[model samples]
Target: MSPSTYRQYEGVKARRRWITVGLVLLAAAFAIRSAQFGNPLIHVDENFYLLVGDRMLHGALPYVDIWDRKPIGLFVLFAGIRLLGGDGIVQYQVVATLFAAATAFVVARIAAPMAGRIAATVAGIVYLLLLGLVGGSGGQAPVFYNLFVAGAALATLTALTRPERNAWDVRRQGAIAMGLIGLALQVKYTAVFEGLFMGLALMWASWRTSRSPARLAVDMALWIGLALAPTLAAMAWYAAIGHLDAFLYANFLSIGDRSGAEAKELTRRLAKAWKALHIPLFAVMLAALLEPWKRWERGPATFGFALAWLGAAIAGYAVFGTYFDHYALPLFAPLAVTCAPLFTYRPYRFGLVAASLMVLSGAIANAVIVRKSQLKRGHQAEMTAMVNAIRPRLKGCLYVWNGDPLLYHLTGSCLPTRHPFAGHLNLLREHGAVGVDQETEVRRILAGRPSVIVDHEPTPRDFNFAVVAIVKAELKRAYRPVKIVPLKGSRLVVYERVEPK
Candidate 1:
């Protein structure tokens, strides 16, 4: 080989090495930043997931024992964490840190071919920097799903760029890509949309290379079938256990059943957030679209498929109808690659550094502002006090009605009700479905007569106010309020059943 060509190859390898080191550093930074205050379970959702995971570790299946719309793969990760001796919130944060790093590595890999080393590193850095920005903390579904989704995308890109004239090799790669997506599906159903986008891109790329529509169509169908294995296997397990119906409801219908005017509120919140974040990301994506020819003129197929990935990610986020800030995390992967021009374009290379600083600064500001203090001093402090003050008063199971799940774990008591968190049940009530009806839950509460009932009211309709209204009335009749501990954004009132006069 010519010395100049060899030099270029060496240069690529050196850039990759630097990118690898940068990703490792950024990941470490993420871990430190995440633990900056403490474990990153900013939302009660993490607590709930942790609770469910612990329950599953004790042999309880999701939806049957404790109900949530989260896919099985989510609980599986949590259960695995439990087995690994890191079942607490701190352990969850550690796992999330690793996932953030692995995903950034995949982002860099996808970007390296099309956008070169600078863009590649930028992609990785973007992911690492933006993870904490959404405030999902360490254990959000996206934390894990992003890694699986990106790995799947990488596999798809690999399949698309194969130079092997061997058909079996192409099919094998395609199946692997789809299989990774299948595993992603198990993490969260949102991966399906991104999977669909990759599937189409793979088909298009395959048709271009093989020029045999019928053959490719057959193989693609098999690849799709391969993708369904994880989901299908899950269904079979639930079916075997005679809880398939519950499985369907939790994974599919529960989310689908959530309807009504609340969706508008979610959209509005999303819109406000989008305005703040749009400029830097949109500018990069716009560059990708405008310079489509340049993006795919050489290198691997990451650029083209990344466009699909972004579209699919956006479509998934929009159609899901919930606009939680963390929901926006999936957008960063495609945005990073699309932003390649930020580093490659001489006029805009400086903009890359500037935009990153803005993102980092903005994230820090948000974390500081939202955290209300250092992580340790914030909600964790309140919860610690609540556990210490309240655990002594508890004799039996703990009941958190429309309140944080950490209370259950912190208080070290069993769950008193199947319906724990109000996040989903509130939506079900808006459907006018008896599925989350107040009467049933009220009966459970009265029957169990939980030793410590924590009633939290920070926001209207944050709980099933209507049903919780009934539950509260019953608790008032049978129990007396023990303590009201005010915490950030929420206050907890502990109720113990009144002893007979």
Candidate 2:
């Protein structure tokens, strides 16, 4: 082709890429805003983040001064957003949208070289839709982690495809891969699965032996070093804060040994996710799988990289006892990548139809599930009102027990007690110091000097202490009962400690 023709072709390709990115950005922004507008009240895990982030934003040092189990990487990301987000939900939405968009772009970049632009576009769309459906409308670290995973996959694929690339260039790709892995680790430790998968692909590529084993060994070493850099930084930060134990024990160990019910619940969720993707992607995958393995051989090493990544991911997830749908997220990218080959086969259209239908059906089912799980707005409003009314009259600093996270976020106070007052009465006996435990626990709290116990719906169990009973009898001896406010068809009680002369 003539010089002018070449320039024209390059310009067109550049414009197409820009357009692709723009569409991804627009779609992600819409999804994030929808999630934000749907529910702003804190949910289970989000509440924990809200509590931790609130403290961190307010000058409380994590690890050094406060107790939380999140890795330093997540804390840094949340802190940066919270600092920039202030009190606005829009800020969170924006961060989430940006991450989702980045994830889509990563998907496209990874797919383009393996499949054509058409396949890449489809993959990007698949990622955006899947994340929105699974991640909900709100932006969270999982969404960010998904983006990083995709980026790592792209880098891994590139490194395998171009073994002849210069040592420095290969090292740079490895560094990018490792950096992405580090970011994923910070987002959630479960992301270790993603790193493991990518690493396996890298190792397999190095072993392909078109080159001398020594050169491959040298290349592998450089790449491994780049990847370890981020994790080491996180560990160093943990050591600096004297939180290495908490990182290792509390976060990692606790997740490992979750209760039976938690494990079962996670398994059930994963089963549902498997069905969601399987029914739709199966047809396409079969065609791709049946195609002459020789056809795949024609591509640069991305095919092998995809195989190793998907395999390692499946194996890693299986090895871990704690299972969640989010844990299965890393697998989605490689599966989707592998699915890209189906679009090229003549019969693959059948799979696309099936996959599209499954996606739609799964999305509808997921929406219903999300809706059922949401707390009624009236319930939230009622709880907030009662807590606000009783907070002022209560003595000492008010702590919320078994209360929603908003209470902490809105009130900016510590937990009512580690042992939630909820329905569990035994918590009262277990942790509530009568003359002795109370004297110690209460004195320690008072040392920092806050009074007042605000609790919601005490649980029923051994030593199950009713909030009403605690206020009326055991605690009333020292705390004055102010009022009981009914919330969302439930009850919230407020009390103040009587000052002793």
Candidate 3:
């Protein structure tokens, strides 16, 4: 107990804190760099939204002109890019990086109040690492949505810890949290689950301390109402135009019904979920679940709330129940928060470190896979060149097969992109799957009488290639394949419909 011994002990503890912080910083640096090092803005979904946004730039409605189930915010945000300048890949990455940094800060803020400063720093770094692993490049909306969700969680945590504050403080914090939730919903409705959960958690924490049901109910109503107001206003506005049908029927109902697609069986869905977590993360989640129970007074509230949030997010995923890996993005916040406690205990710190290393390793592996995949195909660049070459040649209409984003990005136009596999909509129905209306749909597509068809080669064995095949078949029947040329490291097959010229 001598002064010298005490001083030595303090020094060791300080070093441990610095070391952890240093490691966390290293992880953040890796995440930022990883985002900058990826492919161009030609991802499948990115192309779809880029095209939609390009159309909106010209005052074309999404559902009325093209087709998709994405929320309006997604389109509007992209549309803003077209508004300000153009839809270049670099612009998309810039916005993505900014939003991602904000999300990391939110995680740190949420964890700082619950755990110490060091732990909070580590949680933020962990989130950034996980985000780098999952969020691909080029203006992906989900990345921004994830950032908003994290911000909401941080606001809720602040409200919970400060429940004894004056009315103004509670109202301000509660309202901020509620508004974040609403904004999250505006980005993606799946965000609604996490938003509502956080809102309720904040209200319950305030209620537990005050012991007045009336006070609790009123405060809860106020926050929830304010939070949801933006989303309601957006819906009302979109509804005023005939576009409401597209918003509700296509986005909400059609997307919800996509679960029954043959590719979305429950077994496959659960399996993909497991793969996404991997063994190490699964362990972290288990540790997080158990850690709360051990803390007794603090453990019950914090861990129980985490469990509720985790369960709700999982249930939301099950509802969509598609075998897609991105469905798990909404769960990342709870997963990261709940798993953070594992780092506090010394023994668990080793596991936490191990898990982080595994995540880092996985990121490196993914980057390698991305490189290899790109080397295997030259079609994307070739397709881009083909579109550019054909741009001046066609006058009537240009319909892109496979709905490539480069088409719109290069052409500076928002025209319909035909799908070859749309005929499968009928097949999906024969199998009793709920799908988009293809009967009226096919006729609507041909109505454009596209003067040219740009068909990119398909990814080997992807079901989406069915659409590509359908386009090729229809083109072969009506038009002769004029020339199959190679450009920009890939092949482009151009078909010009025969006319009595």
Best by TM-score: 1
- When 1 and 2 are scored with TM-score, the better candidate is 1
Off by over 4 Å in 3: 1-38, 163-168, 241-243, 256-259, 263-270, 289-304, 347-352, 372-383, 417-436, 456-472, 480-494
Model 3 lDDT tens row, 9-95? 999997787566655555564454453433443355665665667677777776556656567777777777666564445555566
Steric clashes per prediction: 0, 22, 2
List TM-scores for all candidates, in order: 0.88, 0.76, 0.79
Residue-level lDDT of model 1, residues 247-350, one tens digit each, is 89878876555654466677777875585457546656556545522644444355666676888988998896767777887887776666654555445555
> Which residue pairs come into collision in candidate 1?
none
Error of 1 at 204 (Å): 1.9
- lDDT-superior candidate, 1 or 2: 1
Worst 10 residues of 1 by lDDT: 425-434
lDDT for each candidate structure: 0.70, 0.58, 0.60
- Please give the lDDT score at residue 92 for candidate 1: 77
Candidate 3 local Cα displacement, residue 259, angstroms: 6.2
Roughly what TM-score does model 1 have, to 2 decimal places? Answer: 0.88
Question: What value of lDDT does candidate 3 attain over all alpha carbons?
Answer: 0.60
